[model samples]
Target: MDRTESKHVFVIGLDDFNLAELQTVRNADEYEFHGLVDYDTMVHPPSYPMDAILAEARETLANAPAVDAIIGHWDFPTTSMLPILRREWGLPTPSLESVLYCENKYWNRLAGQEAVPECTPAFQGLDPYSDDPVGDLNMAYPFWLKPSVAFSSYLGFRIDDEQQYLQAMATIRDNIHVFAEPFDNILQYSANRAALPDHGSGATCIAEGLISGRLCTLEGYVHKGEVVVYAIVDSLRASNNVSFFSYQYPSHLPVGVRNRMISYADTILRHIGMDQSPFNMEFFWDEATDRLWLLEINPRISKSHCPIFQIATGASHHEVAIDIALGRKPNFPRNEGRFPIAGKFMPRVFGDTVVTRVPSREGIETLQKQHPELVVHVAVNEGDRLSTLRAQDSYSYEIADIFIGADSESALHDKFRHIMEVLDFRFSDVVPTNYN
Candidate 1:
């Protein structure tokens, strides 16, 4: 296999240990992990400026000999820098224009509408200050309020009324300053926290209220302008909450409905001119209308898809993504016959801190022992303070995820329910009198 050809890969923004895990996996495969260029190194360090951090990243890459590729997942704008690196090192990558169009929400939506008008939602860009902020309230009562340039759902709000609309806008203006700082700075903290959630803050993005329905995600590999979707998973969000709680593969959707969803996705990717790259596209299916709405498209695969691919098809998304990044065809035919179901259950919280006794390790272990088909990855440790339910909450408490594979959708749901039963946490402490 010529494993020693010196394939130096640079992964930027190792914010939340995602890069660390990825590097660990890559190393196991015998590929040299050249280095990591992160924004967290600058944000927490006092007196750090954009030029200083950029200079450091450049120097790091320059010092590494024969770098083969630069990659990042989860963080968008930071990931967008791959094109810039390619330009600097003369490495091949998708066009910069394509990357920008994908990274910028306003442009991506506009382009998606031009290409796949049916899947896209009714969206508008308002002058947060002057334009009739609430005028669009007529378009849809519960339309989402999202920052034109935002990530992770931090500034997104679901405006059910004029009052909430005004309040959400105010919060967005006050907290989000995406343009003021270097794009790298905004993503660095979340990236680092993703790796070591217990050690530091996590990452977040804003979103208006959700489009009420089941959440489905599509993952694909694009080659020479052609997109091949490998999997579509049905996501289970937190009850009465907007954040995602779990994802189940072999989506429960009828075959016909799944085909339509994929068709819409193809229209979207083609319209955005994203012919090459790994893509993660999210959509919402309203059973009432029996229609699917395109939510967003991520240029890279976040870690959430790892278990789905592993449990369902015995394939690794990490491996496939790496292959695509290196310009090689992914290996999936080995496990291509039957469609197995998979799911990832995210930890749900009721308050800021789960002061109750943590779930019994023995009990969780016993369940795992009983159900070897289930893979549980708990993100929070005992005594960890939980965060709110907003997208910004991702930066607060890391999630505990349970990945399971079952023979049917019902079986997957049953396993997910059992997991919640065995691993649930309860608060044992009394509320402080001064607490709000």
Candidate 2:
């Protein structure tokens, strides 16, 4: 393809690190790329003018040549923003209502109940702004609570007692509306949004029964209303908290379990009317009962797993997102990459602490030298407070992301364990003092 004539794609939230993986797409040579928003703005935009960011997104795209496609793999704003822009420019993408069916937690559960009740857990939406926020909930204590629109499990909490519930409500009251207001503003433009359960602009949240089992994600895309699953990635969490420790592609799940998950996802995606986009759906499988529970369905590829897919399968799943964006059928690879298995591991600290030290780029380089297949990315600097990291989950702080490949699952974990020891992350406890 000639450079001047290449198709122009505006990737809403492309980050520097993931660019390499996108370059390996089979259609890479046929397109040119432009990035619209950095990660921070995409995650949490300034609140003074909720629609200002969307205006800027429109302006940015307008300045470019006719955009062949608008694509993104980030959740929230990206998923929301993509459909909005597509509608504006008369481009092809999933409808905003379809995306919302996957985003709005309360509505998503409602749709899931109708389409896959066997996989849906008991849930109820709560208005955090109410005088008695806890009173509106039908679910009991020990249930999980989270906002209707959030990313990376930002405000999610597991409530065990009234004290914890009260504490969580207080936090939600102060923070939940930030994303909600903007999401509601976007919904105003959707002709199909009115029929869905009104989530009141995302300020509200949901409390659901806890479903525990082996966690994994199905990565795929819908083309012309057909749901196709390309891969499954195991989401391994830290022993004590909800933060993910690693994501391994070519899940080690039994074939029977994997098949059922794919089937369940197909029914739900089709029922909700999601098409012409990449999707990531999480599920939990109970071994003893042999049941699969739906966690949540996200309307984008899991960007964190892109590199691992490339390392283990020759190409990243970004190919699917890109292909679908351009209105072409995706041609995904199978058993094509260097390693049999690959993982993206997170090294986290579970408490509030001040960073005293972290590995330098040079130090990471040395470790990568030792382990030729390793790629280390540190998110903190010396003297930076861990709590100040933007978009961090309330319970834990991730200091670094380690990507690696191995011949087997056990070897992949062993490699991650060895790398964690080599990368030094030192923190000093922050003495708590009431500031109010």
Candidate 3:
């Protein structure tokens, strides 16, 4: 289709991207851009409520013109609604059944075990009511308790002992709930997956945390059952903390290992029937086994790394993904060109809100002045109440994110540390009694 003749694209989640790129896409000329629908607006507290957002989404789409394509930037609701939108507009998409299976961890594990026998993780379904409610203890300690159909590490915990497991279960019970309402009746479609038992609640899924030495993610597009791996980003984390700190592109994996990781991803996508969408597949490298283990697969472009790819290669993954979703064969190259290692660092916070002083504007400005090439995106503002790292945390506490690019890994690391030192934002004051 000609550029002018192409239909307007409806972006579901606008809050996911960094400021610079978000502005670029909003103002780009390649396609007519329509207004965005804040999927999280209806949900209480403005976090993700999968079913409610999907219901509102169908109504929003009904009022808009027949969009050429529906893009899911980073939100879970956008990913879940792909099949429904395809069905509504008679656009090509993966089967709804396939999308459902992939979205739910309960089904993903069951299918992953059947399809890729070697790639499956050790997991068991927990009954809400049981004397031995913990279920099977097949895997070792330091296991992960996660919700079946969720993202952003929400409702997930690392259990180290019996006491910890009990505490974690209490936390899960207080937060999550299985949705019992009929989604089709309310939305005129089956947009709802498992419902939260109550408002602002979600379901839970637990698993034994794999002994992963390092985390790396692969971004790719699948067409006609064939997967084209675009970029592999190695995640950088703090030596002492479990939260992810940054990501460096042009991964330091051996050729054979990289190829193996791609092969594993292909197997999972094919088995899961994700034939017509973009994916961000995360994996952990086991040092002892020298093997790659599947963590989770996201059905959208991995945000915070768009600029990294743009700088590394002249191509944009966002544009490629949109093209593929619109049924246009993208011009992405098979052999990705290696470039300088880029890093994305998220600010760490200790409390719910920035009750105390946070990162300084001057410090950030100084970093930007010192390193003009770096692309930094700060999400936190003064007095903004930070949400929890994982969904299950009682109080939320993520402050900001910083993206930097450099010639080498060491250079990127040094630049990140220097910036953090300059923009020091941590909790030193006592928690306020009236903190809401």
Tell me the deviation in Å of residue 8 in model 2. 0.6
Q: So what's the TM-score on candidate 2?
A: 0.95
Could you give the C-alpha RMSD of every candidate to the true structure, in order shown? Answer: 7.5, 3.5, 5.5
Alpha-carbon lDDT, every model: 0.62, 0.83, 0.62
lDDT of 1: 0.62
Q: Rank the candidates by TM-score, best first.
A: 2, 3, 1
Tell me how far the alpha carbon of residue 26 in candidate 2 is from the true structure, in angstroms, after superposition.
2.0
Best by TM-score: 2
TM-scores for all candidates? 0.79, 0.95, 0.82
How large an RMSD does model 1 have? 7.5
Per-model clash counts, in order, read 26, 2, 14
lDDT of 3 by residue, 284-316 (tens): 777678867777777777876777765566444
**lDDT, model 3:** 0.62
lDDT by residue (1-436, candidate 1, tens digit) is 4666757777766654354445434334556665465645522232335556567778998787667777766454555667666667776566555655566565566676787776667766555654565664445567777666556665667777778878887877665554324443533423223221121111122233345677888887687777788777787766555767667776777778778888877777776566547778888888899877778877777567765666666555766566776777665424641347777776555446654556667877888787775656665566655553233443234346677777887776776776676666555454321101
What are the runs in model 2 whose C-alpha is more than 4 Å off? 45-50, 198-200, 429-436
Residue range with the least summed lDDT across 10 consecutive positions in model 3 = 193-202
The superposed Cα distance between candidate 2 and the true structure at residue 188, in angstroms, equals 0.5
lDDT of each residue in 1-436, candidate 2, tens digit only: 6688898888876777767778977768888878886666775555524487788888988898778888888777678889889888888889888898888888899999999999999998888878876567678778988898888888889999888888898898888777787778877878875667754457778889989889999999999988898889998887664778889888989999999999999998888889898899999998889989999999988889888888888888888888888898888867788888899998888778888888777888888787776778888899998778877876788888888999888888788877777775776875321110
Model 3, total clashes: 14
lDDT measured at residue 20 in model 1 versus the true structure, 0 to 100: 42
